[model samples]
Target: MSTNKAIFTMKLEPELRDSFMAAAAAADRPASQVVRELMRDYIERQRQADEYREYLSHKVQRARAQRDAGDFATNADVEAQAAARRETLLKQAKEAGV
Candidate 1:
């Protein structure tokens, strides 16, 4: 851990703050350490969520371009393909006694 530090202050219900501090003490760790871990975890999760959103946005853009170029399958066409695949799988499953 880095020694560089700054104070962060926030207001919460006194009872909640007291309980959190007591829990930290019971676990033999400082409240600051627990708070820092929580903050870091939250930040990483937010970053991952943002990256996923960006990926989905790009996928949507690509799909839209494909649609515009008349290069994508229609919903009915996709459903028909899926139905054929399902039938083949069901037959295989029956043969395998699965």
Candidate 2:
């Protein structure tokens, strides 16, 4: 029977390694377990960052395409539309007596 465990090796500064060991001991957890958890968290955070960058890239590309196609709104036009909506909402609120 084989255990699902593998050894990972890396080099680190002596001081950092000592500190990590001490902290893990203080927390009453194995240093290897702490390192594994840290690795998992780091991997998850990196994946999320990569996904967000991809999303932002696609959004910028779409915006540029719209602008190139002359399908974008000007700042003034956007402000005017916002103002009209606000005015309509205010009229409705006044009519509702609230």
Candidate 3:
């Protein structure tokens, strides 16, 4: 055990407390360790969620800028280009008998 430690108190429902105690006893470890590990996992998940929110915000801003600058293709333009490519691919596939 480390000499550096902090003291804190937690209030748990009876059922939850019993479950924690049972798990600790089964593992031959302190309940505090299980609680600490659960807390650490929760904090890491929250941090990842925050990072993903920031990434999505940046992507939305970039998309808004592109739309305002008219740097986009119309649906018809995209469909026409895709159709042409599809025709070429189909021709190649037919030639290859695939």
> Would you estimate the TM-scores of all the predictions?
0.77, 0.79, 0.85
Model 1, 27: alpha-carbon shift in Å? 1.2
> Which numbered prediction scores highest in TM-score against the true structure?
3
| Cα-based lDDT at residue 33, candidate 3 | 90
Worst 10 residues of 3 by lDDT: 1-10
What TM-score would candidate 2 get against the native? 0.79
Please give the CA lDDT of all the candidate structures: 0.98, 0.97, 0.95
- The segments of candidate 1 whose C-alpha lies over 4 angstroms from its true place after superposition are 82-98
Candidates in order: C-alpha RMSD to true structure: 3.5, 2.6, 2.2
- Candidate 2 local Cα displacement, residue 32, angstroms: 0.5
In every candidate, how many clashes are there?
0, 0, 0
User: Model 1 over residues 1-98: C-alpha lDDT tens digits?
Assistant: 78889999999999999999999999999999999899999999999999999999999999999999999998999999999999999999999999
Sort order, TM-score high to low = 3, 2, 1
lDDT string for model 2 (1-98, tens) is: 47699989999999999999999999999999999899999999999999999999999999999999999899999999999999999999999998
**TM-score pick, better of 1 and 2:** 2
Error of 2 at 21 (Å): 0.8
